[model samples]
Target: MNILNKTILVTGACGYKGTVLVAKLLKAGYKVIAFDIQWFGNHLKPHDNLTVVKGDVRFPATIPFEGTDAIIHLASIANDPCGDLDPKLTWEVSALATMQLADHAVRNGIKHFIYASSGSVYGVKEEENVTEELTLEPLSEYNKTKMVSERVLLSYSDKMVVQIVRPATVCGLSPRMRLDVAVNMLTMQAIKNGKITVFGGEQSRPNIHIDDITDLYMFFLERPNVTGIFNAGFENITIAEIAEILACKTNAEIITTPSNDPRSYRVNSDKLLATGFKPKKSVEIAIGEVIDAYEKGILVDKEEYYNLNWMQKAIL
Candidate 1:
C-alpha cells in the first residue's frame, strides 16, 4: 500500500510514542489525523498535514473516520502501574475501545488497522527468547488487555488488513518524554542523583529505542503485506546490564535492591527483522540521547515526566 497520499488516523497522538509516530507520518507526506484525550498537554507543533483531535477512543462514532485510509491505535491506560490503578478503566480504554475502533474502521472501509500491542503480553517466562507464536501468558491487566485486543483485531482479518506489533519496552527521548519506562527512569536517576538503582537486576528485559519502534509503525503503515503478530525488540539485556551501561556513561553508583517487580522475558525479533526492518538505534545510543536532553535542559526529573505520578494527579 502506498501511504504517500494516504490519510492515517493515530490514536493516542499526544503520547510518548504517538508524538514521534505522528511526526514521522507527516514528514513522509501522509496526511495525519492525531487523536488523543490530551491527558498530557499537546507537544506537537502544528503542521499543514496534521489534524489534531481531542477525544476518547471509546467513542468511535464521534471521531471522524471519513477518508481515513488506515488507523494506528495507541491510546490506552499505558502501563502496568496505570492498569493496576483501575482494571475496569484499562479494559475500557485498552481492550474494549480498541476492538470498537477496529470494528468502526472496518465499517468505514479503512484498509489497514495496526494495533499497538506490548511484548509484556509474553508474561514472566523462563524462556530465553519468546516469539509471536508462543501462547501469551500475560501477568498484568495492562498486558492482558493488549493480548485480548490483539486477538480482537486479528479476528477482523477478512474485513481489514490487521497487524499486531508487540513492541518491547521503548526508551529514548521524545517531545512527550516519559521517565517511567526503565531506560529513561534509570538514566534520569543517574543524571539527577548520581545513583542508579537496580531492582533484582538479573531479570531479562527486551527493549527497542523509541525511534526504532515508531519507525516500525511507519514501516507497517505502508507495507500492507506484512500482517500478523510480530515481536519488535532489537535487544534483550538484563536490568543489571542496563544499569552497568548507564553507570559507565553517567558515572553513577549502582545501587542494588531486591526487586518487587519480577516481570522478565527475553524477546526474539527475528520475525520482524525478516521483514527487512532494521533498528537504527541501540540502548546505549538511547542512554546518550537522554543525557543530551538533560544537558540541553530539555528534560528534567519532575512529577510531570513520570506517568504514574502525573496520572495520579491528572486522572482520579
Candidate 2:
C-alpha cells in the first residue's frame, strides 16, 4: 500500500504520544484528522494537511470517520492510576469505544486499523521475557481493557487489516509531556526534588522511546497488508536501574519506598525486529532529551502534565 496522501484518523491526537505522532504523519505526507478531547490543551500547531477535532471516545457514534483510509486508535483512560479511579470509564472508552470504532471503520471500508495496546498486558511474569504467544495476565484495569480491545479488533481482521502493537512504557520529550510514567516520573522527581524514589526497585518493565513507538506505528500504517500483534518494546530494565541513571545525572539520592503495585514483565520484540524494524531511540537518550526540555523551559511543572492528577480533576 502506498500510504502517501492517505487520510488517517488518529484518536487521542492531543495526548503525550499523539501530539508527536500527528506531526510525524503530517510530515510524511499523510493527511491527518487529529481527534482528541484535548485533556491537556492542544499543542499541535496549524497545518494545511492536519485537521483537529475535539471529541470523546466514549461516544464513538458522534465521531466522524468519513474518507479515512486508516485509523490509529490511541485514546483511552491511559494509566493504572486513572484506570483504577474508574474501571467503568476505562471499559467504556478503552474496550467498548475501541470495538465501536473498529466496526465503524470496517463498515466504512477502511483499509487499516492500528490499535495501541500495551506490553503491561503481559502482567507479572515468572518467565524471563514474555513473547507474543504467551497468555496475557493483565494486572490492571487499563491493561485488562487493552486485552479485551485487542481481541475485539483482531476479530475483524478478515474485513480490514487490524493490527495491534503492544508498546512498552514510552519515554521521551513530547509537545504534550506526561510526567506520570516511570522513566519520566523518576527523571522529573530527580530534577525537581533532588531525590529519586524507586517504589519496588527490583520490578522489571520494558521501555521504548516515544519517537520509536510513533515511528513503528507509521511503519505499520504504511504497510497495510501486514496484520497481527507485535511487541514494541526495546529493552527490559529495572526500576532501580532507571532511578540510578537519573540519580547519577542529577546527583540525587535514590530512595526505596514500599509499593502495592508489584506488576513486572519483560517483553520480547524479536518478531518486530525480524521484520527489519530497528529502534534507534534509548532510555538514556530519552532522559537526556527530557532534561534538555526542562532546562530550556519547553516543559513546565504542572498537574495537567501528569495523567493521574489530570484524571482526578477531569472526573470530578
lDDT of 1 by residue, 152-263 (tens): 9888999989989999999999999999999999998899899998889998888999999999998998788999999999889999999999889989999999998786
Residue pair clashes in candidate 1 = none
lDDT of 2 by residue, 122-236 (tens): 8777888889999999889999999999999988998999889999899998889888888888899999999987787888889999999999999998777677999999979
| Maximum-TM-score candidate | 1
List per-prediction Cα lDDT, in the order shown.
Answer: 0.90, 0.89
Candidate 1 lDDT trough over 10 residues, lowest sum: 298-307
Residue 80 lDDT in model 1?
95
Show where candidate 1 strays beyond 4 Å: 1-4, 260-263
Best by lDDT: 1
Give RMSD (Å) of candidate 1 vs. truth.
Answer: 1.2
**Which ten residues in a row are the worst by lDDT in model 2?**
307-316
Residue 186's lDDT within candidate 1 is: 92
TM-score, prediction 1? 0.97
Residue 236 accuracy (lDDT) in model 1: 90
